[model samples]
Target chain A: EADIYQTPRYLVIGTGKKITLECSQTMGHDKMYWYQQDPGMELHLIHYSYGVNSTEKGDLSSESTVSRIRTEHFPLTLESARPSHTSQYLCASSGYRNEKLFFGSGTQLSVL
Target chain B: AQTVTQSQPEMSVQEAETVTLSCTYDTSESDYYLFWYKQPPSRQMILVIRQEAYKQQNATENRFSVNFQKAAKSFSLKISDSQLGDAAMYFCAYRSAIRNSNYQLIWGAGTKLIIKP
Candidate 1:
């Protein structure tokens, strides 16, 4: 089983609320990624980190930001949430390039 | 640019029957990886099977098997004795094997598999 974890399995917040989605893994993986997905849709990569202190934006443009201060932790924060930001956020990690990714349960965020 | 295509948006099959999900990819690189991932409702995504470009043999795991035609750039997943647990959104992904590449996977839109009991 994958050791990755994402907190707040489901979240409902009002617009303009600042929120943070937590992601952590115990497998000591060097590559961590955050993807946004809608119901019955393809996953869109939002952010990824190769290792500590390294972060890059993905193909999809996202208003959220992420920080990789530690190998096990990568958190995404939204300064001001909007209804457009409501979507399922998934966290994944891989040990090496081209390796299969292990995913977390995902956080479903809803902004009212 | 590499692209993965899953033409079937949704597929249905009777329980205990067999079903196939089609996937095609466009890539110029000869060496790369292909993957099948399953996402159950309100659950995490998990790897179901994978096929390497250079491998002539198709990859199989338990009830799941892949028909990989590298020449046609087609990779299809076939599930035997389909079960209710197999109902989920299946995604096809492709990753380039070229060195120095970021190793990001290009994903298909996904196919929703429904097993009718």
Candidate 2:
């Protein structure tokens, strides 16, 4: 089984509320990424990190922000939730030399 | 620019049968990587198989095998003796092997595979 984990498997909150999705990996990989997926559609890259203290926006523009203070932890925070932000967030990690990505179970966020 | 395409949005197959999922990609780079990833309902995405562009031989993992046609730019997945557990969204992804590239996977719109019992 993959060591990557995402907390709050499912979340539903009212609009304007602040929320944070947690992602952690025991693999000690330097490259981490967060993708936004809508149901069975294609994945949209939102944020990624090369290592601790390095974060970059992905191909898609997202309102959520991510912080990689530690190698094992990468958390995404939304200042104000909106219905548009209601989508599944998936976290993944990979070593610098390995191109394979290990993904988390994903967190399904719903904004009411 | 590189792009992956899964023309079949959805496909179905009887359990214990074989099924092929089609995937095609376009890229100017000669060397790259092609991957097949499976995501079950609410489950984490997992790598099914991988094929390096430079290799002439196809890659296979257990019942999962890929038909890699470099000249045609086609990488189709063949699942033998399909099981109900194989039902999931199958995605085709491509990554550039060039140095300095972000190594981000260019994904195709996934194809939902339904295994009928």
Candidate 3:
């Protein structure tokens, strides 16, 4: 069973549209991360949060923004989506005791 | 900067046979953790096995085992008695054992395992 969950497994939107990807973890993990992946490619870290009110940009640059107001809830928002934003967004969470991450079903976004 | 590489983009194996998937990483840090994750057609990323760099002993779980060569910077997953369910995209990952709660994971391009009957 997956402790982490992501909403809207698949999405298609026009350019200039705004969208938010929701991620929630039931495990109450303090560490949450967002990774962008291309088909058959390596995963690129885009955003991460240590806990509530803590968020940081990852190694990879992204136009999207993320907020961690609640311990279990972390959402990524793209104010103005573009074709370059079209990719799979994966949400994951991990506890401090062990660094093993629990990943959620990724959200595939397509911008036309 | 750390980088993990999986040379084989794809590998084929017959059912009930053994196969090894190669993984090598480049890092200056001495202490870290290595992992192998499997992503099947279901698209769910699952943890297959893990190895700690500090340990000299290898890690194994049932049909899955890892030949971790810390000095050589190599971590390979060997599957014994391959099953159809084992056919999936296998990824190698690296993580620092640091105390930072916001630790990040470094991943490879992944190798697709094909099981033939």
Off by over 4 Å in 1: none
Residues A1-112, candidate 1: write the lDDT tens digits.
9999999899999999999999999999999999999989999999999999999999999999999999999999999999999999999999976479999999999999
TM-score of each: 0.99, 0.99, 0.96
- Give per-residue lDDT, candidate 3, residue A17: 99
2 or 3: which has the higher TM-score? 2
User: Compared with the true structure, what per-residue lDDT tens digits does model 1 show for residues B1-117?
Assistant: 999999999999999999999999999999999999999998889999999999999999999999999999999999999999999999999999899899998999999999999
Clashing pairs in 2: none
Per-residue lDDT over A7-38 for candidate 3, one digit per residue giving the tens place of the 0 to 100 score: 88999999999999999999989989999988
- In TM-score terms, candidate 1 sits at 0.99
Between candidates 2 and 3, name the one with more favorable DockQ.
Answer: 2
N/CA/C clash count, model 1:
0
Go through the candidates in order and give each one's DockQ: 0.92, 0.86, 0.65
Higher-TM-score candidate of 1 and 3: 1
Q: Which regions in candidate 3 have their CA more than 4 angstroms from the true location?
A: B100-102
Provide the lowest-lDDT 10-residue window in model 3 chain B: B96-105
TM-score of chain A of each: 0.98, 0.98, 0.98
| Candidate 2 residue-pair clash tally | 0
TM-score of chain A of 2: 0.98
Which candidate, 2 or 3, has the higher lDDT? 2
